[model samples]
Target: MKSTPSNQPEQSVQKTFTNLINALEQNNYTNFISQGNPAFKEGLTKQIFTHVSEQLAPRLKKGYSSVFLTKLNQQGYQVYLWKLSFKDGSDDIVARLSLKDAKVAGFWLN
Candidate 1:
């Protein structure tokens, strides 16, 4: 889809996505939610972050990269998609990140 100013711009958010991965690898809960929106920061507790970090740590350590796919404007957020490829040649995963007011609102992989 074409870019829109209302939704957070993709250029900056792309870099944030990389930072998210870095946070996961390092298990830095503070850094992980540092850029999150107020609601996101409140909702994503350190316990939750720790759990996710532990789960994804292996793949993260193996190294990975993402390719921007598209961005969708929905429910007052900018939903960005990417193709996440692991360096270990594991199957690729679809990564989704939602941003509100230029901050991360939600994120997941499928």
Candidate 2:
């Protein structure tokens, strides 16, 4: 499906989040980073990517169960939050993502 500005912000953010998850699952950090904002790309290097991948590998193994939490608009950016459940008994993952210009401007998986 083609995505346009008229699409719901939640739908757009969800699609982007799904794609990011797929890239992470496949160990395609390059593809994953390419989707981020310029500053995100600059902040994440190969070493950092490797570290993050290692840290997330275990929880990601069991995949995730997600519940939409909320949405907010801050400084012209659209932010979406999701509560993620993992099998490893870790704290629930709170995924906070900010979207700008149809791309991911920021992302946090806590």
Candidate 3:
């Protein structure tokens, strides 16, 4: 089940999200994890990063816009969700970003 919270995150989170998205688009593993927490960085190695990047390359290359959806709080972490709409007629992607202590705990796209 999805938790459709009433509010979206603040502007700061939007900036962080943009940075993360840019890193992904550039396929820079180091920059991608630059804002991540130790655990988050440890969980993703270069091989894993390459695989995911390969899978997302097509969508990432195209112009897209993201709409803030809602935020969820879990175990002292803030999890924000966004919907990405592609200009090339690809399917939308659901982006989830979790932050703990002002650092990225994890990020996923589905």
Candidate 4:
């Protein structure tokens, strides 16, 4: 799909998630999302909360809770970045995901 200003990021994120979920569902991998990026795509996978916590422990700011998803163009492919955070000095988690073969892959905690 051609990218648009209003919903490009959301569309890409949804597509990436759907692609991963569909592939797992078709293969009878019901616990795919819950399993957390077990299938590596582009050398990235979903990171555990523990891993995320450690990364954000030092950079967290107060009242800065928010989750975000962004679509980026890289080397001729689309990449997605997701960030989850909480308010009032809470930990923040960030992940980078990529799409490949109609599947979500390549996750990293930031």
Candidate 5:
């Protein structure tokens, strides 16, 4: 299904991780980089963001934004919003890595 960002989590973290692992188990990791157009890649990245955000945000108190993504450079990984909130009035973040090797990575939300 096409992924749409929202203000909440769609499932649990364990479930998101399991789905990612299952997807990897079923396909080669390098294929996402080598086999798709930019739009397709973006779509995949959004899906990952949605899944991770849905799984992690509920454990925190502040509101998390549904969309956040930027490619830092040609090689550096793009940052996608898995979760974004306030902790002590500072940005708290949980995100997924969109490098050819997809994985979860946490960072300061700001």
Candidate 6:
């Protein structure tokens, strides 16, 4: 879906998150980090990505499902909450996006 001006930021952030997950699943770290903000890009490395992926491997074994839970806007940042469901359990994923610039400033899978 295309985003209109009114809801462009939210839509863009959502799309970014979707694409990031797809890239990660495909082991395409370059494409994944390309969607990040400057700081995110600077801080994330291949080793870090590998470590994080390994840590989440158990929950991702059967693959997973996701649902958009909510969004909170504060201090120019839009924090999107997503619920990730695995075969064994569930967890929360947080994406702190900078809507003002349409970039992902931070992300967490817990």
Query: Which candidate comes out best when scored by lDDT?
Result: 3
**lDDT of candidate 3 over 67-92, digit per residue (tens):** 99988899999999999999888899
lDDT of 5 at 12: 46
| Per-residue accuracy of model 1 over 55-87 as CA lDDT, tens digit each | 887987988877788888898988988888899
Full-model lDDT for every candidate: 0.85, 0.77, 0.89, 0.49, 0.41, 0.69
Candidate 1 colliding pairs: none
Instruction: Compare the candidates by TM-score and give the number of the best one.
Output: 3
Model 4 ranges with Cα > 4 A deviation: 1-12, 15-30, 33-66
What does candidate 4's lDDT look like per residue over 4-109, in tens digits? 5633356546665544433332432333343234455223333443344444444443333334467777875567766656465455666576655445556455
Q: Supply every candidate's count of residue pairs whose N, Cα or C atoms clash at under 3 angstroms.
A: 0, 0, 0, 3, 2, 0
lDDT of 4: 0.49
Error of 2 at 40 (Å): 1.8
Clashing pairs in 6: none
> Order the candidates by TM-score, highest first — what do you get?
3, 1, 2, 6, 4, 5
lDDT of 2 by residue, 1-110 (tens): 99444333456577888777766666678877877889888877878777777777667787678777777889999888888788777888788888888878877888
Off by over 4 Å in 1: 1-9
- lDDT accuracy of residue 39 in candidate 5: 51
RMSD of each: 3.6, 5.6, 3.6, 8.2, 12.7, 5.3
Looking at candidate 4, the ten consecutive residues that score lowest on lDDT are 21-30
Local accuracy of candidate 6 as per-residue lDDT tens digits, 74-98: 8887777776777776654543434
